[model samples]
Target: MTTIRVQQHAFDPGAEINSFCARNPTSGGVATFIGQMRDFRGPTRAEGETVAAMTLEYYPGMAERQLDDLVKQARERWPLDDVLIVHRHGPLVPGDAIVLVAAATAHRSEAFAACEFLMDWLKTQAPFWKKEATSDGATWVEAQASDDARAAKWKK
Candidate 1:
């Protein structure tokens, strides 16, 4: 099964991973990645060294569709028993979990690779925009070429 959602509430990584692995007797390993809100800043926010809060914005339909596609691609490439992706939107503080990717497979290698692949693709391709509230003010962070480059490596 594949599950994807954009929620305002926080998620429990253990529960999410366990739900994905449940009823999958063939899965020998499960890998999970959780992304957190960090104190990231650009030139505009250099004056503010800390991220007080952040709000994630997304085109509801588009974001879900893009994530669904990535999950499907991962399933095709690996013998995955299950995959679950959940990304939270709305205001978040530093250290809050922003996203979660969990994958279950028969082998550890496949599980690990698929988890990494899902996270990389989501970082580059997902249509979510983030605005941070810093000491200076709120600003939208631009996407970097490095993120695209990281995702491109999965194609090879």
Candidate 2:
């Protein structure tokens, strides 16, 4: 089973994960990743404007098609019993959950790896464009080299 959703409202990651596990009761392990909004900029920068909010934008059908392809790639690489991806768009504040990914399989290794793979792809390859609001002003977030490096590691 594979489930995917893109919405503008807030979601409870704990509830979503629990439901995923319940629906795949026979799977031995389930790994999940929840991505949330943050207040800071880069990892090493000690001084700069902090992010107050963010807005994600995308074309509905295009985003869904990209997500489906990502799931299909994950399934081909791992023997997964189920997968779930929930991503939010629109205006969001710091500490809001932006995305959730879960992978269930017969072993911990596959579950963990697949979950990580999905997250990496989502971070770099997903179709959504984001704009961050800071004390200075709102700016469109650009793709970072570090994110591209992480996603590239999974490529054959």
Candidate 3:
């Protein structure tokens, strides 16, 4: 089964990973990625210090649709046993896992590749917006051209 969830509360990666792998008899390998909040103080800010919090927002229905599309694409390309994606919204602090992607496959190579592919697609194409709160103030992080290029590699 494939599951995608968007929530305000935290999650247990170990539990999620275990649940994804438990019933899949055909899956021999499972790969997972967890993205965390980074304490980014922009170059212009005085005294480069840790960020206090990060606020994430997304268009509810649109974000879920986009993520489902990404997961569907992964399923079309890979012989995956299972996949799970979880992304959190609202305020978060450093070291908090922002998102999680897991892929289960018969082989490690496929599992790893699919996991990476999902993350790259999410980073570039997902409609989530992020703002960092620092001592100075809060600022939104712009999407990078590099991220677009990274996502382009997966296209046929």
Candidate 4:
């Protein structure tokens, strides 16, 4: 099973992982990653800028198509039994669950790698535009070089 969802509502990552594991009974391992909103951005809280809130915007039709394509790519590269990706949009506050990625496979290595690959692609390639509301004002989030470097590894 391959599941992809993009919505504004929050989701329970733990529950989603448990559900994926239950559905893939034959799979020996299930790897999952949950990305949550933080109060600040940058490497450290001391140096990072504070963010009061965040809003994500996207072209729904295009976002769904891109997510579907990402899943296909992951499946082609790994022997996955099931995959799930849930991403949130719209207004969000600190500590909100932003994304969930789960992958089940017969071995831990494949499951781990698939989950990592999915997250890496999502962070850099996903079609979501983010705006951060700071004390000063709101600013559109820009792509970071670190994210680009992480995604580039998959190309090789």
Candidate 5:
């Protein structure tokens, strides 16, 4: 089974994981990754400008299609029993959940790898635009070189 959603509404990670476990009882392991909004940004992530809010934008149908395609790619590479992905757009403040990715498989290794692979792909390829607001001004977030490096490792 596969689930993909893109919306402005908030979601509960705990509940999502529990639901996934219940639905895939044959699986021995389930791995999940949750991304949250940060309050600050800097080298060491301790000092710097504080983000008041972040706005995410994406084309509705196209965004979901891209996410669904990534899930398909993950399934082709791993023996996954189930997969789930949820992403949010619009204004998000500090501590708000941004995205959730989960994978279930008969073994821990497959679950873990699929979950990580999906995240790495999403970070680099997901067609979403993000703008962060700070005391000074709001700026569009650009893709990081580190993200590209991480995603590249999955290539066969």
Candidate 6:
């Protein structure tokens, strides 16, 4: 089973994983990744400015299609038993959950790899724009070169 959901509300990653693992009887291992809102900006947290919240925007139909395509590619490349993806949009405060991903497989390697693959793809490929709200001002976030490089590692 491949489950993908784009929602505006928050989600619990632990519950999501438990539900998936409980339903998928054949999975011997499960891996998960959660993306969260960070409170700092600049070179590093210690030196960066404090951020209050972030607002994310996306075209609903297009975003879902993009996510489905990534899931399809993951399924093609791995012997995954199941995968779960849940992403939240709209305004979010620091420490809030932004996305959740879980990949289940017969072994730890597959589970871990697939879980990372989903997150890496989502970071670079997902169609969403984020605006960070700080006490001073708000700014749109650009994808970092580090994220691009990470995603490119699994390129075809």
Predicted structure with the largest lDDT when compared to the true one:
2
Off by over 4 Å in 1: 40-48
Off by over 4 Å in 6: none
> What are the root-mean-square deviations of the candidates from the true structure over C-alphas?
2.6, 1.2, 2.4, 1.0, 1.0, 1.0
Residue pairs with colliding backbones in model 5 are none
Q: Residue 145 in candidate 2 has what lDDT?
A: 91
TM-score for each of the candidates: 0.90, 0.96, 0.91, 0.96, 0.96, 0.96
Compared to the true structure, candidate 6 yields what TM-score?
Answer: 0.96
**Which tens-of-lDDT digit does each residue in 16-88 have in candidate 1?**
7676777576789989999988875654546546778999998889999999999999988999888889999
Return the lDDT, model 3, position 40.
59
**For candidate 4, what is the total of clashing residue pairs?**
0
List the candidate numbers ranked by lDDT, top first. Answer: 2, 5, 4, 6, 3, 1
What do the candidate models score in CA lDDT, each in turn?
0.87, 0.92, 0.88, 0.90, 0.91, 0.90
lDDT-superior candidate, 1 or 4: 4
Instruction: List, residue by residue over 12-126, the lDDT tens digit for candidate 2.
Output: 9999988999999999999999999888776743775689999999878988888889999999999999999999999999899999999999999999999999999988878
lDDT of 3 by residue, 1-156 (tens): 788899989888788877777877678999999998776564543656668899999889888899899989998998998889999999899889999999999999999999999999999878899998877788888788888898899989
Q: How many residue pairs clash in each candidate?
A: 0, 0, 0, 0, 0, 0
- Report residue 54 deviation for candidate 6 (angstroms): 0.7
Clashing pairs in 3: none
**C-alpha positional error of residue 107 in candidate 2 after TM-score superposition, expressed in Å:** 0.2
